[model samples]
Target: MDTRERLIESTRELLWERGYVGVSPKAIQQRADAGQGSMYHHFASKEALAAEAIGRSAEQLRAAAETQLSGPGTAVERIGAYLRREREVLRGCPIGRLTQDPEVMAIPALRAPVEQTLAWIRSRLARVLAEGREQGEFSSRLDPDATAAMIIATLQGGYVLARAAGTTEPFDQAVTGTLALIDANVAE
Candidate 1:
């Protein structure tokens, strides 16, 4: 690939592997096999490159979620599909991981994409819950927004738990348990 594309891709991979605080421009340049001048020419600074990488990652995540969200199924079914979708549980959610980075969150531009990515996922879940209510699949009393937040939180937290334990068991259990809870709440 070209220097610009290589730089962005390298940054994305490094960001996922090392996080915002851990990654450096020099490392990115080395990973990209591009010189300092090439990288800086494309991105004004490390933060600028990271911002672009985060934005790209966010877009990719949203697109993946939309695939499951728009598929043919009931609300819970679609959500289950999303939760069960293949992922690198050990690697963690690229966007979610950014939330743990003080450097990324401290910068408004860097944080925006991360925040928007998570908010979109939560909003999508809430919309699904709303649809379930309209279709008599869920109780009218169930709070869509709250439920959505809980679901997203469970997934995000699952990653943290799994990472801490150095195993995928916690992540799998979290999904299983969360799905069971959702199923239990569904209208019989």
Candidate 2:
């Protein structure tokens, strides 16, 4: 990879592994195998680089979600595919983890991508649910917007629960339960 790409990728990994406060420019330089001059030449500051890295992470997250969400299937089936997709559950959601970082949340530039990405996911899910309702796959009682938010909550909370217990069981259970709930709501 080019020096710029290396720096961004290194920052992305560090940010995911070590929250905002824990990551340092020196650490990023070493991980990227680039020097201080190269980093400064690419990014004006640590926060600037972090913002770029976070934005890239958010873009990847959105694209991944879109893959399962927009794939051919019933709404619930598509959502189930999304929830069940393989993930590094122990590592937690990259963007979601950033919400816990005081520095990231305190900085609007760093937080914007995280916020926008989540909102987009929620909105996309809601659209899928709404389409399912229109297609008679879901009952009229199903609230697309509310259920979309719930799905996101369950996923994010599952990560926290799994990390707290140092296992992926909690996350697995959360996803299973969520899929069951969605299935239960299918039109009779």
Candidate 3:
């Protein structure tokens, strides 16, 4: 990879492994195998580099989700596919993990991508739920906006639960329960 790409990739990995406070320019340089001069040449500051990295991660997350969400299937099926998609459950959601970092949350530049990505996910799910209701796949009593929020919460919370327990079972159970709830609301 080029110096800029390597730097961005390294920053992404480092940010995932270590929060904003934990990542240093030196660490990024070493991980990217780039010189100090190269990093400074590419990014004006560490925050600048981190913002780019976080933005890249957010883009990837949205694209991955879109594939399943927009794929050929009923709304519940598509949502279930998204929930069951292969994930590093133990490692946690890349963007979701950033919410726990005080530094990341405190910095608007660093936080914008994370917040936007989450909001996008919720909005996308809400749209799909609305579509499902229109098609009679979901009951008219279902509230797409609220259900969408619950799904996102379960997903993000599932990651926390699994990471805290040092196992993937909690995440799996959370997803399964969510699927069951969606199924329960299936139109009669």
Candidate 4:
């Protein structure tokens, strides 16, 4: 990869692995195999580079989710597919983990992409839930907005629980419980 791409990608990995406070410019330079002059030449500051990295990660997350949600399936089926989609459970969600970073959230520029990505996920899932309800795939009483929030919360919380326990089991369990709830509301 070129210098700029490598720097951005390196920053992305470092931010995912280390968060804002833990990742340093030296670390980014070393990881990207770029000199200090190269990094400064491409980006004005660490915050700027970190923002690009986080934005890239957010876009990837949105794209992956859109594939599952937009493909052929009932609303519940699509949502189930999304929930059951393979993930690095132990590593946790990159965007979700940033929510725990005080420094990232404290700065609006650093936090916008994370906030926007999560909002998009919840909104997209809500749309699918609404679609399922309209098609009689799910119960009429199921609130799409609330259910969407719950699903996102469960996935993020599952990551935290699993990371804390040093296993993917909690994450898997969370997915199972969420699927059960969605399944329970399936139209007979």
Q: Write the per-residue lDDT of candidate 1 for residues 79-115, one digit (tens) a residue.
A: 9999999989999999999888999999999999999
How far out, in Å, is residue 180 in model 2?
Answer: 1.0
How big is the positional error of residue 143 in model 4, measured in Å on the Cα after superposition? Answer: 0.1
Clashing pairs in 4: none
TM-scores, each model vs. reference: 0.97, 0.99, 0.99, 0.98
lDDT of model 1 at residue 143?
88
- Writing each residue's lDDT as its tens digit, candidate 2 over 58-90 gives 999999999999998899889998999989999
Residue pairs with colliding backbones in model 1 are none
Instruction: Assess the local accuracy of residue 174 in candidate 2 as a C-alpha lDDT between 0 and 100.
Output: 99
Candidate 1: segments with Cα more than 4 A from true spot: none
Regions more than 4 Å wrong, model 2: none
Steric collisions counted per model: 0, 0, 0, 0
- Candidate 4 ranges beyond 4 A from true positions: none
Q: Given candidate 3, what's the lDDT at residue 89? A: 96
Worst 10 residues of 3 by lDDT: 11-20
- Please identify which of the two predictions, 3 or 4, would achieve the higher lDDT against the true structure: 3
lDDT of each: 0.93, 0.96, 0.97, 0.94
| Rank order (by lDDT, best first) | 3, 2, 4, 1
